[model samples]
Target: MVTDKQNISVNVVDYPYDTSVPLLDNEQFFYIRDEKRHKGRGLAAILTQPPSVQYRTLAERVKNQSKYGFPSHKLVLLIHGHQSFKNALYQPLLADKLSQEGYYVLRIDFRGLGDSEDCWDPKLGRTIKQDVEDLTTIYEFVSSEACKLLLGRTLTLDTIVAHSRGVISMFEFAREVYVPNLINCCGRFDSHGLLLKAARRSPTWEADGGFYCHTLRFGEWQDVWIPKAETLSAGTLDSSKFKEIDSGTWVLSVYTATDPIIPITAAAGYSNLFAGRHTLNIVPNCDHNFYGLPDDPNKLNLSLRKGKVNYGVYLVKELVEYLKEENQLERFYKTHQLIKSAKNEGDVRNRWCLPYEFSQISNFRDVGGYTTGSGTQVRPGIMYRCANPNEATAGALDYMKSDLSVNKIFDLRATNEAIEGGIIPEFDVENLSFNNNMTLSPEEMAKHYQGMFLSSYNFPQAYEIVLENSLPTIRHIFEYVLDGNVDEKHAIVFHCTAGKDRTGILGMLILGIAGVDVDTISHDYELTTLGLCTEKRLIAKINGRGDKFYTILGPKGREIAAAYGVTPTEMAANVLSSKYEAMRLFIDSFLSKFGSFDRFFYEQLKFNKIEVEKIKFHLTI
Candidate 1:
């Protein structure tokens, strides 16, 4: 949709922010009353284009999601300033504009503002610190399982557009957690500036606890009693100590040219603070609220038009341009790319598969972005596969904990294959190992892997053994989806040591079940070797270790390795892969027996009709 000025206009639907659903006359949008009262703050939120979702139960919602393709792949979080929310402010327009740009907007209402619950305390309500806490809580909630389940699709905070005082809280949030792209508009930083502005603006300001301010709303002035000792406690927010977003974060700071409450000169030096990709854009001829009326020295005796055209649209367009930047789009899709391209350390860092130098984990990929042959795509962030979580680097562990949110791991390694780093992860794990007793001698194991060419039947026999033995466990894993608790099982990572053989077989099954074409599945399986090659390159380069690290140790190294049927190249491939033909033939053999995946689920796995329906409902688009 486009506004009169051809400004992009995005439509929004209100969905559940909290656990409860709101009453709505229009099913497209929901109106959640801001009645949540917490520690001196209240909150509410609007979910834009929440997959056109309106259902009473989680199953119904998810089924509906499969029926209606979720078109918007991006999610944006819009946080309001000091005393604002969506409606009765310019934030709705901003949210809609972002929606028009294919971003799902979660417009937040801070406590004690808009239609949200009221805060009785002055210092505690909407203070920078408290607001920062609110931001963290809201972000966590938004990126959580319940929130994703409600939307019937996975969502991440792509860009955060904050106005006025919300920017300070966002800055604090940027330090506490990752803020993808932060757009700060007319934000006041530093404690002295805010208190000085407060004192100057409020009529009944006092040095003591009792201060009357018009902050609660425009028409009413309210008294907030902060004790003399605690009066300036939260008022002094220092941005000097904040961390730089230089490490692959995008920051854009905008200010109104004529913002009376926040001087343009105050933000003039702000751009110099960031060492990363940062832009400072000042919207000309606007006030702090941008489109809202400005406090002009020239308008002493004049009355004005209510709102002709929101001069604010110009300011909001800046946000759209920033959002539309290629870097931002890459940042958005990088999460969904299962097989990452190792172009550089910077590009590697932006993706989910962290390099081996920083990642003990190998072949880590969330299996959510596979596009089915029928056109719908598997949602990202839920299904995942990686090398044993037990072998993950500290950075990789943190990534899994904070970003990937892998709560359950299914170990597909044999007892010996998973040794030191084989203990269950921090979260729950089911020790479902296949090929547990395939104890060929070292020479025989090497030959078994080395002699398996693309046309060789040994490859298919190998994976068929895996499929035959692992069917029961795999059935349990999928059936667990319908066990009534989807929250604790948000992301399920199944893996062996290299995450290639057993893990790849399972990945093929998952992709095949999701209706991704066999060709895509073959390529996805092929990525294991590429990903492991990246690991090998990293291992070779780390600490001045060169290619010799991956090659024979000496003249006898090749002879010794070869006697065990393990040359350097074959040795590396042995650990990382067999071939896609292994899975292809294994699946072809399965088809020869069971006929179809549906039949295999019924005959081999013994899933009843209802269970089969549940599997189709959960896995398919």
Candidate 2:
């Protein structure tokens, strides 16, 4: 038993088994938050010393504690398996290890198992329901104001590590409660397997009311009772509950390939169920307890077995690495103030080219304030560029419609793309299918543009193809804008998927026709990169490319990659970039071909001089 110098009342209870470990300096008693308090109803927990207090002498540690308080603000809960205590297997080692890395580690023994209260009855034994209740009580106590008053400092519950049966309880708790990180070690996926194995082992045990088995308790064999109620409860546990675990929780499931108790397929089951937010790791040559097989002395060579190796080391290694990565990411976000910046819209607004802030939109801004050659500025609030506004929140959509006075939206995506990305239902949207002739169906146009993009060497070539093919759409847009329909009170928004490639081309044309310089046009194109920093559509596009480019280029893809010293994925990411040089090159090539925007509009788009002058007159102040 341990005492706090602050004279906090701690009701210490002795365990059923002996816990004479050398690492008992951090032991403490926490009363279970149970209203019906029977005798011996409490929790036995070990709070490991963090790095700042671990190496200090007793006097120095007490002095430092008196002055500066607890070292860690992050708390990690370590839960043991069925028929196990707080210090079983890797719990103690992992607790100390994680504490040394600046986390407050709490290893607790569940009720009726180790040093906790004996609430286990022969009829109602230790059920999964009971385990879940125990875990909830402990979690509540640790997170409550009562615990804070005792500790003298608040600790945020960061991660939970559970083994075997405790994994079930942890995941069940996660159905309603939220924890940032979860680690599962040697956990069974289905309860049916446990029932089947038990039926085979003890066929008449249920008929006999209960069975007595010799199980390891703190490294010693002890007579343990396996009641009928326990078996029935374990058998009735629904594995579907795992799927109901919170999606935001990051899960890391670790299993050994050679584990006798739990099959390897359990890992795959968790991987499939968790899908996006879980990682599965399988350690080699280990058992359920992560103990390695002893080398066979009868064999000439010791090739098949690892001689008494503790594979628990590998488990701890994976845990440490995963926790370290999570800690580093948390620290990085805190240090860079990204969370605060994301919340404070002003910071993100000032970092970009324009001052528009839409709740559910990215790269949505007014394309205004560009000075033409004649000193007249392209009028602001009349034109905008953005990614798809389909997912924009109601408030953001209202802000766009009422606050910004947006009246029209020119969607430069293919017909299929428009249907797939959806449109702002509140706006009058025109699907400017930029394919030649506009005769192809939505799907055909989508495939056609995809082929063109995949075939082009760089964005400049792609932009040229788009400009050439989309002449009809371009003519319609320019004519519509100049047809006395748009004014300062009403604005128009144009976008493709990311408001980068096709959208950039259209922006260049409008700004150029408004007499904006080539450098400003190029800068406007480059701003798309910053605009898309928070956008996932660009990432989806890059990932969606997959091996299509590799397959298309075949041997030439390798040659090109070798020439540029980049991988296929890198090449794909480059194709998705909105670089200044790419737009500048496209503009230079266009001017070289048609001499000026006037000739290009007249020759390519067949726009008359009156129409061009009307476009210039309407877009500029």
Q: Pick the candidate with the highest TM-score.
A: 2
TM-score of 1: 0.46
TM-score of each: 0.46, 0.50
List candidate 1 stretches off by more than 4 Å: 1-42, 50-70, 120-123, 202-204, 208-210, 215-234, 244-246, 292-309, 325-327, 330-621
lDDT (0 to 1) per candidate = 0.57, 0.68
Clash pairs for candidate 1: 10-100, 42-111, 360-393
- Give the per-residue Cα lDDT of candidate 2 at 402: 80
Tens digits of per-residue lDDT for model 1 on 238-288?
Answer: 777555542335678888776778877657556766643567887666567
Instruction: After superposing candidate 2 on the true structure, give the runs of residues whose Cα lies further than 4 Å from its correct spot.
Output: 1-20, 24-33, 37-39, 53-70, 215-221, 296-307, 325-621
- In the order shown, the candidates' Cα RMSDs to the true structure are 18.3, 21.6
User: Residue by residue across 4-101, what tens digits does model 2's lDDT show?
Assistant: 33322244444345455645455453544354332454666667757555534332432343232325456789998877878777787787677666
List clashing residue pairs in candidate 2: none
